[model samples]
Target: FASGVDFHSATAVDMFPHVRAAVDSGEVLLEWDGKNGTPPKPLVKDKYASERRKAKTLNFSIVYGKTVQGLSKDWGVSLGEAQELLDKWYSARPEVLEWQ
Candidate 1:
């Protein structure tokens, strides 16, 4: 199905939508009962804020024309690492790098 596109979105052109496995698929905080007759409540959560925040910073940095040096400084990583990360990203999405 062709979902409605968000043309007004800032990262609409940069990011591709993806579906991942549910975070709380197996991990559950079940209420204990005296008897084992209680039905299990399916825990449902799929948020990973910290990792998402890190990725968001890197992504937006690239979108705003950040260089490998700037990325290295922002992430406190080695310059080589920063360059490698940028290289990996550009390799994965060649069209984006080509567009820029």
Candidate 2:
């Protein structure tokens, strides 16, 4: 299950090379650590790594038609937090946002 999430997350990033490059270059900071090479360190560290993970999950959930209330309950966050995460995702991925 964990690996599946990681794969999905990695694949999601792969679909957006520009976004991944931004993350790698420190121009953007998403939940997961950006893989550099032999030594793997998060491109940008955050105290709320878990929260960020949840945010990423919520992003996928939204794409799958999950509702704000469902995401809040599933991720154990407030409705506002779930909404904020979605908002941040769309803001960062303007191409996807525009497509939607």
Candidate 3:
């Protein structure tokens, strides 16, 4: 949604007090548990690390109108790999791809 869509929105000040009162009730727990879940393993370091980050960057940039050649040069990937990455990104986020 765009920020412009909220232009017509309004709220009653009278509702704010009740909302604040509900928030003060211990109904919400605002702290995280101390357990630390295992973090994701870092992507393997290889000749492909730069290639892969480049590929993803190309996909991200192209979605916003960057040309294939410019994205390839900026991200240092070949055009074919950039195209493949764009395919993968769209496959992963079909809704977003549809929006594009």
Candidate 4:
């Protein structure tokens, strides 16, 4: 990551090879520090939680570039239901919605 190799250009599946190779070759090490550092909390609890939930909900939308019908088929829900969820997700994360 520090090597300035931007992995964001790679697809989700495409990056797996490098990650797997790193672990398989023991090039990666995992350790936990015993420091009791306080984890910074969210600035807006309710809205942040909502945004997080919405972001998760929209992951499928982005990953699949789903249409209402496509989301309906994938989630086994009606098109209207999928659209409603998608709408809520967009409302919660307008920037993400704007990107799409």
Runs in model 2 with CA error above 4 Å?
1-37, 40-56
Return the lDDT, model 2, position 26: 63
Against the reference, the lDDT scores of all candidates come to: 0.51, 0.56, 0.42, 0.46
Backbone N/Cα/C clashes per model? 0, 0, 0, 0
Candidate 3 clashing pairs? Answer: none
Tell me the deviation in Å of residue 13 in model 3.
Answer: 44
Question: Ranking by TM-score, best first?
Answer: 1, 2, 4, 3
Is candidate 1 or 3 superior in lDDT? Answer: 1
Clash-forming residue pairs, model 4: none
- RMSD, one per candidate, in order: 10.7, 8.2, 17.6, 14.7
Q: Residue 27 of model 2: what lDDT?
A: 65
lDDT of 3 by residue, 1-100 (tens): 2432211110111112332233255332212233665323321112124443444444457568876577567758899865655565555447775676
| Model 4: worst 10 consecutive residues (lDDT sum) | 6-15
Q: Across residues 1-100, which tens digit of lDDT does each residue of candidate 2 receive? A: 3443443344345435554675677664445433554324343224234444544665678678787788778878899987865665666556765666
A best-first ranking of the candidates according to their lDDT comes to 2, 1, 4, 3
lDDT of 4 by residue, 14-48 (tens): 22344334434545322222264632331221223
Using all chains and alpha carbons, the TM-scores for the candidates as numbered come to 0.53, 0.45, 0.39, 0.42
What does candidate 1 score on TM? 0.53
Report the alpha-carbon TM-score of model 2 versus the true structure: 0.45
Local accuracy of candidate 1 as per-residue lDDT tens digits, 1-100: 1333221121222222321233224333212342776436422211333334555576677889999999999889999999987876576457787779
Better of 2 and 4 by TM-score: 2
The top-ranked prediction according to TM-score is 1
